[model samples]
Target chain A: MPKPNNQDANSLLVLGGTSAVALAYARLRASEGKPIILVGRNSDKLKLNQADLAARTKKPVDIHVCDLSDTAILDKNWNAVTSMGHNISEVFLAYGLLGDQLKTQKDSQKFLASLNTNFVSAAMWAEKAFDHFAYKGSGQITVIGSVAGDRGRQSNYHYGTAKGALEIFCDGMAHRAARFKGAKINILLVKPGFIDTPMTDHLDKGGLLWASPEKIAKITLKAVFRGKRKIYAPWFWRFILLLIRMTPRFAFHKTGL
Target chain B: MKPVLSWGRINDKYCNVVRADYFADPNLLTIAESSDNGMLLAHGMGRSYGDSGLNKGGVIFQTTRQNHILDFDTQTGIIKARAGITLEEILRVSVPQGWFLPVTPGTKYVTLGGAVANDVHGKNHHKVGSLGAHIMRLSLTRSDRKTVICSPRTQKKLFNMTIGGLGLTGFINWVEFKLKPIESSYLETENIPYTSLDEFFSLSEESAKWPYTVAWIDCFAPKSKQGRGIFTRAKFSNYGALDIHRDDHIATWPFVTPALFLNRFSITAFNFLYRWRPGARMKGRSHYDSFFYPLDGINHWNRLYGKAGFFQHQSLIPLERSKEGIGDLLDIIKESKQGSFLAVLKLHGPEYSPGTMSFCRPGKGVSLALDFANKGQKTRQLLERLDACVLKHNGRTYPAKDGRMSAQTFQTAFPQWTKLEAMRDPKFSSSFWRRVSQTTS
Candidate 1:
């Protein structure tokens, strides 16, 4: 778990800022009177969320609408936000799409599109955050991974593959940042299991196993504060994932988790 | 459609839950008008203990996503926000900036809209009155699809009715309210144990000047130790020494404790251990969260009451008769040997709520909240007996925490409810309203 520091949460730059996890984090920081800039599509939700965050934090919150699918310069959005005089001290890369494996399996366009938004473009955005953190010699980044990425499942292998790749990237980034002696940046790989968010609202939900976005946000922020590199949210998921990992491949295929 | 229950986990109802993002959503008013059975009402955090926020066989217009704060004035301390935002969210931002809700109930999870609709009072009812006191202006859409902005200065009738109108007047769109200025997120506090009802009254009188005062009484205490508990007084700590951050651990109740274990013996033991606390540690500074919402530290603590679920019987009687009324009520609970772990008593001053249907009036009122494990009809009979005693003393019970108050009890307690009923949106109703109206109508 990451422990929150008295680190004057300078300014936050959140991409796909309207996602449940993203919005929940924004709400948490907003309540703490921290300044934030939300970047996402859907101008209405952005405006509404911006208003919600503004009222919550009593701090100025700016919204920049960008289809992550269209443009590749959200680092420019971060620059635009920072140029407005808000320093980007903490950056959360929280934008992604949960690709339907069936659709991706049917068409190359769908597979490429899913990979572009969930992994390719997201990785580019992470690189931008890394470069800025590397320059400052200090910063924190929280990249949301998933339990789906823990193993290849028939239901969502595309989404899992993209997230799995992001996990490896975080592992590599941790070492790279560590190797740079002056780099004070900390990167955390957050694997949240079965979060009850709007994106996953279509699925049937059960008791105790599901985590609300607010609960996940609190865990993620605490992890960021502790500067813990890898974590399974809700604490119990670590054991659940461990069990899933240890299962024999032949038995795992039959169980169909 | 999904099944939802109140915070008490009692009064479960299934409804087509629709999340409304903004007032502009066309489906907002349409859903209410189109409900095939019962009425449509907006539901926010679902923190109400009873069915006041529940609508069976209808649509629930969920305002959680509509929780956007529209504007804020730093210097004036006035904030404009959508009705769906919670006090917890507000406190998170405001406390750090030296601003706090003028009046907040026991929990911070309640949404702004629900707080106003319930007209909730706090321990400081002696000073600030109910949550509706600070609301400057708010817009509510009626069944006719007309949005009206009601304030004390304009639309006085609806303003008074809607303040504690139980969200029947319409779906509250947004609200603008003033926040009280505070120096820090900590409070200077003192706790003095009182052995009897007389001592509790004296403590309240001595601490009357304090902004906040409340008591934790042992409902199951023997006659010799009756009304015995701690009386706590608090004032805000100074700004310069303010921590301006929260660093506390929060735990959750993972599962329901079995019904058999939550019997009289278990409850009595829990009450004894709880009352024994604070006597050894008489005085100290405490965080505002611990001061206001102690139960929030443990998420879903209500599950301790068991799977059958529990409902709180919170009734307030007049100040002059509190000693007699509350004493008699506690005696009944002691004899029954079936009640709660948390029995709260607070002295309400002459501060009046602007809502015509507001529960708080000029009284030295003591609110006794007992959580009864649902033994089916047995629980209902227990609450009804308590209600009979409270009503005999010219007292009123809070509808927000009620699931079983008789129609006569509600009508007699809140006479103005009739006038408000006439003004309510035809398309908006709740299970609580329908239940209580059974005999009254």
Candidate 2:
């Protein structure tokens, strides 16, 4: 594995900065003196997360309020931040909603909202970040995916389908970024199994392979620095999901997973 | 049923119960089988010091309940039973019939499955090797949940991997291995004391000519008497000369002696008395139970270290580094003033099994076991210093006894960690692995 570079001394932009994973990533990186621009929807939540990052790194964290759902506002914030003297070295796209599966089945609005948050917003953010990295010819983009995307289950097929689309989008984006001159952008699709986070707290007990956020963070950092392709946060999830995916359809359906 | 905390002991910050369980039906077979998951392996007696018998929160098709003798071929001394059979139970049934477990640990409370998981070795490791070498065949449940019978000739990799794989590759349901036929339950033993380090090494080397040999050293001894201990060697007595004690199963010490009981003053007094009391014993006779597990008589003996628990730093330095490495470690321990009453030094013969990860190697191995008072930062610092000495001598620490070494030191000690990591199923993990790898979740 490559040692962490002094890129922390440079300026960075996080498209969904209020994300727990994003904030954690930025805080760990900021400790090395990196300046961070945190873009999110809620100012209060973003401020709280920003304070957490600042406390750990003791470095000033800049926050910009912009709803990712609003393309105009997101574009405005992106242009304004890039217009500043800060040269963005890395961009972390970490934003998604675990929309209620039952609610989505009954309400068209819930289904559309889940689809938009999970896929559309993610693609838009990646597109903008890819364009910036393509222009600079050097940057890293990491998009957090889910193990759910490996195969659809009866319980959360809708959510899985959305993440599946997002992962494929990242794959395409990585291919495009490779062609840009001086652009060293690589899309990291983090396929984490059940994570014990605020988003999934209300759900029933998770599978035996559930990983904690801290574990996910450590593994993610290692993968990013190592430049691993399609990294599984805990690494064991790859084999487990592979086994699950390879099982015969008749036997798989009977598993009651 | 609520689980009672009977015989609570701590090792390396993790608390374990020597004999604690919630279930009541001893004849029950609670197999949590799944079609997709592998066949359920049962863990009866939890004598596995490491993660061999444990997978945190995973299904353990507990076979403690099904511990019944299904059949016994007394003519050939071949016995078969449900997988939950324990060595203690087997000893009770078969010892009178002139048969004993081919290999055993310091304790007889371990189950058959546990014996396979750890592939435990005995004082006779030099002669017979580990328990895995004696097994004829084992019934395993593969990842695909198929009941597969494996031996050295069939499913060879699975057989080898499952023997010492710590139960990660698959679960072992039933096993049949050869048992050594003993002439009697009595042992003709000899205890020889050595005052100097050199004397101890030479004596151990000389005693290895016998069938079984082990030495118990006082780790707290001063440099003037470093490596001083009693070398005990024994073999089964002939039928006519044996005095069997069948009803001697009662354990006298059921609880830990007070915390202050094992302090420096007491330990020093105990060591002095032990070395001098048995001054000249050429030969003697004793029951096999007493001869093998002397400390087993003391229930909850780990409680002697108090509630904070203790760390067992056992290292095997190569024969080339024996003199200097052992001397340096002893000096460090003395200078640090760490009170360790029990330090065991043994001579390891050539590696016998195909286990690539076995801690045993061809060398004169010295295992120094210490009972740290678990005094927060001070204890950790001492352990780190000891770790440095271990690394300096190119020695490796036993994973079963490790409780305080850092992840870096662990990686260095076991360089095959990356390969092991590659084979690990993310869903299967242990508290030991998680702590060492810093995988919190």
Query: Which candidate ranks first by TM-score, i.e. highest?
Result: 1
List runs of model 2 lying over 4 Å from the truth.
A1-257, B1-8, B11-43, B48-61, B79-82, B241-249, B252-256, B278-282, B361-364, B422-427, B437-441
Clashing pairs in 2: A8-A34, A137-A182, A137-A183, A236-B426, B26-B65, B27-B65
Task: Compute each candidate's TM-score over C-alphas.
Answer: 0.86, 0.56
Candidate models: Cα lDDT each: 0.82, 0.66
DockQ of 1: 0.46
Q: Identify the leading candidate in terms of lDDT.
A: 1
Q: Tell me each candidate's i-RMS in Å.
A: 2.7, 28.3
TM-score of candidate 2 on Cα atoms, chains taken together:
0.56
The DockQ-derived docking category for candidate 1 is acceptable
The digit string of per-residue lDDT tens for model 2 on B119-224 reads 6677877666777777878876544346678788997766766675555555556687767888888888898877878997788777777778878888777679
